[model samples]
Target: DPAEAVPAIAPTTVEEVNTRFVVLAELYEHDIQDFHALLEGHEAGDERYAERVDISARAVKERETA
Candidate 1:
């Protein structure tokens, strides 16, 4: 699943900044899990490495947008 959308405006207030931080934290947490899964799949010599890599790439793109 994709992370929640962040405020489009620059975070000018403390609350806005905090909200952004929370959103980013959640995004990174999921990113870490995706990477872990990719690594495990690589180590096991899984036939689906390419698919896992695509997943990881998409997750990275999601992070970039956030």
Candidate 2:
């Protein structure tokens, strides 16, 4: 059943879990912003980097949606 599909939580402190979550969130935001800047740079005629930036932006969007 559906209930059995869920995984059990470990016996960790709430503070520890929150701290780790914040760190990961900050990293994600930083990467998204960096990609935005790269996209802007590419739009200004940086053909060599445009594709990579575009891909990165798409990836970020997908993750956000998920």
Point to the candidate with the largest TM-score.
1
Cα lDDT computed for each candidate against the true fold: 0.87, 0.92
lDDT of 1: 0.87
What TM-score does each of the candidates earn? Answer: 0.52, 0.50
lDDT of 1 by residue, 1-66 (tens): 244565466539988889989999999999999999999878787657767999999999999999
Weakest 10 consecutive residues of candidate 2 by summed lDDT: 42-51
| Clash counts for all predictions | 0, 0
Q: Write the per-residue lDDT of candidate 2 for residues 1-66, one digit (tens) a residue.
A: 989999998888989999999999999999999999998987777765787899999999999999
- In model 2, the Cα lDDT at residue 3 comes to 94
Instruction: Candidate 2: give the clashing pairs.
Output: none
Off by over 4 Å in 2: 1-10, 46-66
Candidate 1 — which pairs collide?
Answer: none
The runs of at least 3 residues in candidate 1 whose Cα sits more than 4 Å from the true structure, single-residue gaps closed, are 1-11, 46-66
